[model samples]
Target: MTSKANRPCVQKLRCLLSVAVGILCAQSLAFRNVDSAAFDSFANLTAKGLDSIAQFGPAGSIALAACLGALFYRIYPNFKRVGKRNQLISVILSFFLALSIVVPRLMKLPNVSFNSFPNYVGGVPKWHKPIFWMVASIQLLTIGFTLAVIICWLMRKAADLVECRNTGEVSTAIPPTNLSIWERGVRFFDGKPMHMTVATLAMVLCWLPMLVIQGPAIIGVDSMVQLVQFRTGHVWDPMTMAELPGYVGQDHHPFFDTYLYGLFDELGLWLGQEVLGFRILIVLQSIVAALAIVVSLIWIKKRTNLPDSCICACWCLAAILPAFPMYMSIVLKDSTWVSIFLLWMVAFFEVIYRCNNNHAIGWRLVLCLVVLGLFSGLTKKLGIYVTTVSLLLAIIVIRKQFAAFLISMLVPAALVIGFVPMVVLPALDIAPGGPQETISVPIQQLSKVAILHQDELSKSDRQAIDRVLDIDHLKPYWQADSADYAKHYGYRLNASSSDRKNFILTWIRLFFRYPKDYIAAVPYLINPFVYGETYYYSGPVRCGWWEAGGSRILTEYPECGLSYTQGKIAIPLTNALNKTPPFSFIGSEALYTVWLPMLALGLTISIRRYRNLCYLIPTVVSWCSLFLLPAHQVRYTLSFLFVFALTIALPFAEVLTKERNISN
Candidate 1:
């Protein structure tokens, strides 16, 4: 004890003895006095710090805290050793993961109010119990920090693997001289060329079973409206005249989609079987979409240094995911938009690849971009913004190819944006949609404020709101999850530009006055995607005699209909597939639109692969666009899944490859 070296060893022994004693005390307290049922409930409500108090009594709480401190003492050093980028990514990913876990539980907890004014404005919640908040905060911070440590370790290992691969230090596992049957099966297609024909055939075959079950097309409400518009030369609603005063066909939905559906309907009518037209259309869309998926995969294989097995796995996923086949059978513009957008993304990425490698740019490629750009921009409203913004970013990065990129993207996009809205819609006598569509989020925010704080509204604020909405009447039509009823059914469509402007200014002013309401509105609407609320992966076939909000279109047009012919097989199989664990995860919209994107971007950034991030541009921009749009419905995020397939699957391909000298 007198010697300095001996004192250090003695101190270490003392610390170990104290930890052992505390752990023993904690165990004794837990077994002696705790009521299992009450303790379990309390544990569910709060973090373990508070749980220790309930489960182990006051004395053991102190011991548990000491034990936790020591545990952190051991963990801190490893966290400090990682690079700054890795540390940052670990923190961000941990926060997201913790929220993903905690949010659903908190949302579903009975008698707990999460959306009170005080909660949104950084004050005590309606629960008003300091102990509850203290416990909740402790749990959240503890879970987050714990996840950060785990993520840091994982990233470090991944980085090491990547470094080893880059330096040719890591080697693939060697199979035994006597390979097993399973290993032999895996090795059979190891080096075979993944041609487009074979790949497309595989994907199309995956879709054919669903088509056979719900043949002639599975129609949605929007599809029915478009079909009716074709037959009558007007949108299904006679209300268009009420809104716009003299419009027959409105460009409210994409007119191009309407025309296409009309032509297909006409084709079926002329062929003497109306259902035949829809069947042909569904089949053609499936085949074309399958081809586009394969094309994108082939392009990715050529451009990136990913393994063939990885590419094959991705093709398998695209072919088998329930959403792809389900949407292929359904008549929605989103399916067509995604297919064109896939081609457009490939063409755009190839241009960037060529520019980066200093290869000569070709005219055929530029023309392809122009043509695809035209179709992509015209496909959906969001496509215009995605293509235009991606092109601008490309120009900024590859300034050497500025004019070519600009003309390739900008010319087609510019012409579509300017001419279509200004020239084409008017020429076709189709009035552009009302401003109500774009103001979904703002109107939703207004609904929350109006419903909760009507007594506090100033007179001028009331007038501004009254121009676009009747606050007193909104409550009956208000839905927390969507602004559809509120924006369209409850809105004053006659409101002019100046009226909208005044309302927008009033909205901004009131946001400062009632910040809590504005803040709470977003999560309320998007809880399905962000807060783990359950949603349908696909809907049942709406064919013969089904109604859209009690519309008579299906009842009236009996000849132009088909039914779900194999419900006995299709229904049970669909339910089982959706409820299955891994399949369920793959089909989830959150995986595509939120979690996967966040995870992929985080990993890439952590590894400092900045250039590789360009592949995520289309997906990230499309996701961001949801904030300003009407809703974050599953169909809206369908493109995210296909767009991200190549980029997100890259790491798996690289890490598992037998080849050692892969580039990062």
Candidate 2:
């Protein structure tokens, strides 16, 4: 019987190996076909008589694959056991190895043409080349080999360390505590109907709007049709670039747009249905995002042994908490990015807290960084910023996993430098010799005109205009249009040659100088969150502060203050309580209100007893940061509210638990 069992296991292993080899071969063939096709079309695709892949070489492919592989590896059980130091060394070596391969290939293909493919294909062609195939393959192989070596080394080292710590000792393990609160909580709620009910209710409440909007789009609704038409034609205005009338425009930085529309286009092409296809894609993504949230929440509940009700509340709050619904309904990048971000956060927390030891943490960290980095790179500029910040925070908190964090950060850095600047900027024709020149002319002329007009205005009007135009105090435009002021005005405002650099430095200073103005505009970042129909309109509608016809609302209805005012009140209240002696009662009462009460409660509870709840700090700070930073628009604070809701609820959950214990 034992021999029969052993034979079956051996057969199964052989079969698995056969499948793996088949997959590898198939992938190689597919890559070759794609690469040949790309090379054939290169002449039609190049604008500067240069090869796209040849110029950039295989670096991106290798970098992208390595990053992606690291991310995927985190989900694997085996890699989760590698030590942090070993993992870091492996990643660094692998990265350099990828670069070594790519640099030589790029040198070899320096003069190749890139545009022929598009010309031959007669439409947007997928450009897959052999260089990329080779690079990606090498990346995969290197990372896999490096990781295996690191794991083996770490395992051996761990064994030796264990022996050294407990030499000649034979000890039995102690049993786990039976009376632990978490254990009891799990036992009490196991297979209970109430747990399921709470979870179901929370999910429904949080995700119902997403379902309503997404379902219609998925099923070929009229609303989606209108939205696509408006977005393609009005929003983008691609006709001018094509030198044709009404061709529907494309955003050169079309990662978000393409992602949103490509799904529809693909579905339509496949099914012979164009109008309903894009909408269905959007709806499907929303559904998937909602489901992912539920799944993550379930995982959290299982892992943390937190009350089912608490988990349910967090899920519901995350889902319906306003920010998600507004963004997820639109064909924007935020929904997808936010969904991925939340997933990453969950994965990150799990890897840090639940991993077996330093080795597991290291591997998991590497994986998390890769996923987060890729999403950030492929999504939006903000995605990169968020990813960097999150990775930094992870490294700081999980000091043992710093190597993984650094390796992960390289993914985003590569995207920003290689993809965004080289690929995206060139495609958009926003390069020095591109359409940016035209845009810069108007911007520079406008700035000069505004300044010239400033001299002719009345003293009071001049003061107000000066306050708005404070160019000396304001950060200069950075990005592609740094010479904008000088180009139009015939004089340089700053010594910097790079326009983007000047703008960033100036913007940074301006933001620091008037932090309150920046914070007030947070709510206005989301369109629906603003209490008006107009794009620029924000805040409460009672005063029409942001309304087109309510220009005098600020003066006439001063009592209906800006949202920033409320945030300002919150800062003092929170700050005073934290100090040795609290601030005067008069100022506190002035800012006190029922809605603002939660802010105080949240701060108080966080400071007093929940200081260890570090997760809450980011949300709180993000909320406060948006409120206190530049441009306090209603939509800007939408994400803040979603986070704020969870922060407030945690304290209440604790209170409920305490009450229950006391009563029992």
- Give all candidates' CA lDDT scores: 0.63, 0.39
Report the Cα lDDT for candidate 2: 0.39
The best candidate by lDDT is 1
Query: What are the clashing pairs of model 1?
Result: none
lDDT of 1 by residue, 1-664 (tens): 1598797775677566446544443332222111112224455433543554554356646656476446544554457668787888889887886565444433422322322111111122223445444534554566567657666765665566557657777335656766545343334233244545666777899978777765546676666666765675444342222434355566667778878877887888899876677778888888888888777776655455444455667777877766677778777788778888888887877776666556656888888888888887776777878888888877776676776777887787777778898988888877776678777778888877988887889889888888988766778777655677677566786789999999899888898898877866665445434423222234444432233232433333343443545456555556665544345556655666666767667766666656566666667677567777655466777776776565564343232234333221
Tens digits of per-residue lDDT for model 2, 1-664: 3497697785566455444433332222113222233444444323222343333235633443444344333333333455454455445444443332222222212222211111111222233555445544653564445434444343344344334433535233424664444433333223355654554455555655443433222211112222343334332222122222343323333344344555565566578655346446555655655554654554444433234455545554555433344345444454455566555555554454432132344565567657766774465444565556655665666566556657776666677646766786557443212233323322232233334344543465433323323434323431121333333323232223355344333434444544544332222222222111211111221232122222322233332333343234323433333221112211111112111223324323322324224444344334333322222233333333323223333222221122222110
lDDT of 2 at 600: 28
Q: Estimate each model's TM-score.
A: 0.74, 0.42
In model 1, which range of ten residues has the least summed lDDT?
Answer: 114-123
What are the RMSDs of all candidates, in order? 8.7, 27.8
Q: Which stretches of candidate 1 lie over 4 Å from their true place?
A: 1-88, 108-194, 234-248, 355-362, 396-400, 451-460, 528-536, 543-566, 649-664
Q: Report the lDDT of model 2 for residue 594.
A: 14
